[model samples]
Target: MTTREEVARKAGVSVAAVSYVLNNKPGVSDATRQKVLEAIRELDYKPSHAARTLKTKKTNQLTVFVNYLGDAFEAGILNHLEMESRMFGYFVNFQTYHPEREEELRHFMAGRIDGVFLLGQSLRPETLETLHKAGIPVISVMKPVEPGPVTAFVDIDWTASLQKTIRHLKSEGHLRIGLMANLSETHAHRTRTLAFRQAMKAEGLPFGETDILSGGGRLEAAKAAMLDYIRIGRLGEHTAFVAASDLMAIGMLTACRESGIAVPDRLAIAGCENVLMTLQTTPTITVLDYPRPEASVAAVRLMVEAIRGEPVASRLFDSRLLVRQSTHMGG
Candidate 1:
């Protein structure tokens, strides 16, 4: 709570002197540094992170911006990223990013973090431009946006993952497949959708407009959407569905339970992201192992190097098909 002004007043020096002492800059003499250090000890003064960032131009602090946190989408990523970043002597923080509040986001990120990570949150072009102008590196985790100069991507290969998922569904006796995904046209969502289409085509399955169900990438929303779909009886000839996210798969399962529909037997369902929740479900859900642990470590290491002025490159991990009770057999 002690400010530089208070430290300066206590040390009988100017605020700039306190700043110089705090930063270990060359301007402060040895005598002044000792005085400031003594005063800081006496007053229990702690230099503000913002002040340190301004003085040194390096905070050793990183932040991950996400649409939501604590849910399944971020739990694995955060755990691994924080652990790996700490091993490199960097601190990690999480911020829930809001797309509509670009100005606030831009202001909050300035001088607060050495690097930024986008955990499946979509940012406008201008926002990324602002971060780039500020010389802050941006890395996308999990679901990635479009490839560009501003944001580097880290995720699994969507095409290969979906192709494997489609093949799994095929072996399970599913022909008419549906894709549960986010309605927003974010590059991450688009990539999954396109991969689904490509995979279905390669597997010789039927994919049409009606086969895609927009879930907005939320559990409750997907549940509501699926409930409506069931009421309308629009699920004609579709024996199975693959969710772009595990959350959506769980949501659809809830809807089926409420509607007295059985899973696997009546409507087989599989999803992506083998989050922990998938195993706990009554009928364990099948999924594509997203390799979050590996992805997180890779993302943080790359981000740390990028923040340290090293050459950085995007990384894509492989996804493994996990078959569970929901899709027949165990994962």
Candidate 2:
């Protein structure tokens, strides 16, 4: 815990001289530099990384901001981002982005990270503007619901994916379908919800407000929501469900177990953003492979390009259905 002032006092030189020596900047004599180096060694002083970053104009560090780190889909994306970014000599940092934690995110990201990766977290226009004005490059892992001059973004076509999922369920003779979407309003959720409505209309199926339930992006919350639907007899009509996320699908599966409902027999379920845990469920849940690994690679590549003053472009990956034990056989 040695300060430049202490080093200066010990070396019998001004603080500015110690700074110049530590940062390898000009305007310090060799004798003064040697004295400062000796004082630093004697005191076992380590230069501040924050101060050093300011002097060098780079931290070799990037940040990945997520709404929740515990989410399996997000975790998978983060894993790939870290691995790919490291190959380029960049270290990754993580921060949680919540509505209540906006101020904390702003303060933490200011001039600290060389770049940022936003994973499905919505930001205010002002916040985005501030980051743009600061000359910090930011890449979004999901398309923002609101349009802005964001540096870059990567996403998949949720509407087309959901339409395919619904068509599969319909072809399997599922008359009534329900949607499990997160409570929070995000571009992914909104797109999926709208897709569900459009698909239901195309198939001539009835869609009701109650048919779209909030999955809440948590195991416990989704289970509780499904349990509530069951208690009210609302769950009896829907033959199949399309969940916005795998965690919510797993939660609904748990609810079906507690209610003596047999999956793919009395009810079928499918999830978006397939995670590894989906294979571990009692009856493996069907899901849409989100191609997040590829998105991760693309995000990092675009971010590094933007960091290097190269032109950047947004990217979109593909999503495909993966049938499993949770859903009935279909054409």
Candidate 3:
């Protein structure tokens, strides 16, 4: 319950100067800012967000709207986003839009946030329109559609990234490859599947229906699909397997191990999102490095630009294939 007034008195500055320093607003010198910060630390002062928002009409908060993924993956990205937002004196709020309720979307749009970042698998056109009309600057982290005037986006070039993976596999003499992906009605899954098919076709590689495995994003779902493929005796026939995410890749790897199949020697595997667990595995999975920190930084920069009424071009980052023991042979 320490107050800003106590800190201002300790620092010998006006309450307004304390406000400017704490809020990181303009019109405060660096030396005065340091004094105010020291006083705040010594006095253990915590500013009231409610009071600050009421007075300035700026919440200094941003929202990230995504589907409900598991805690581990979501926490990794959220931590990076929070760190980047802290540099600009902003806080992040995460909201999961209920799949069946449009009212939830409307409720979240009712003025608790200054800007929004869409991380959902899919965003309806009407919802986008509503957010645009509300003048809330939005930046999409993945699967962004054609944004209107007030919105921007930052994402990986998924098609090219997949193409790079395919080329690496090809160089490793992998002609027959399989793809394991989640079959949820998500824009990202669909787009990446399409990219995989297109890349396979362009390389004149024959990919049959059996080569594509689909399931939910759960480990059990992935294990079930992979085991089903194995029970049908379709596992090691393909030279390589490319999974949509590291989680799925781990499941696929587990399935292969349980089935008494050697990795890389019999079936090479690669995945996206170079998660830490992938590196700690026996074969050390090869994956595409998506640069989550860089993407988060770009998203905030674009959001701040839009907040300041400045123009920003759509931002896209490249994903590089990280080759490791999982895909290496004859070394």
Best by TM-score: 1
Candidate number achieving the greatest lDDT relative to the actual structure: 2
Query: How close is every model to the real structure, measured as TM-score?
Result: 0.84, 0.82, 0.82
Question: Cα miss at 154, model 3 (Å)?
Answer: 1.6
Sorted by lDDT (best first), the order is 2, 1, 3
Model 3 lDDT tens row, 155-273: 78887898888889999999999989766665455656777888888888888777889856556677788889889987667989998778888888888889887788888989888
Q: Which model is ahead, 1 or 3, in terms of TM-score?
A: 1
Record all residue pairs in model 1 with backbone atoms less than 3 Å apart, i.e. clashing: none
Give the runs in model 2 whose Cα sits over 4 Å from its true position: 1-48, 186-188, 199-204, 329-331
Q: Which pairs clash (backbone N, Cα, C closer than 3 Å) in model 2?
A: none
lDDT of each: 0.82, 0.83, 0.78
lDDT string for model 1 (1-331, tens) is 8888999999999999987777545678889999999999999988777657776786778888766674686778888889998997778888777667779878877777778887765677787788888778888885555565645678888888899988877887788889888867663666788888888888887899888888988889889989999999876568888888888899999999999888888888998889999999979998999998899988887887777678888888998998898988443
Clashing pairs in 3: none
lDDT of 2 by residue, 1-331 (tens): 8887899999999988987776556689899999999999998888888788777666778988877778888899999999999998889988777777777777777878788888856677777877777778889888766546778889887767777788888878887899888756754456567767877787788998978888787878888999998898886679999888899999999999999988988889999889999999988998999998899999999998998889999987788999888886531
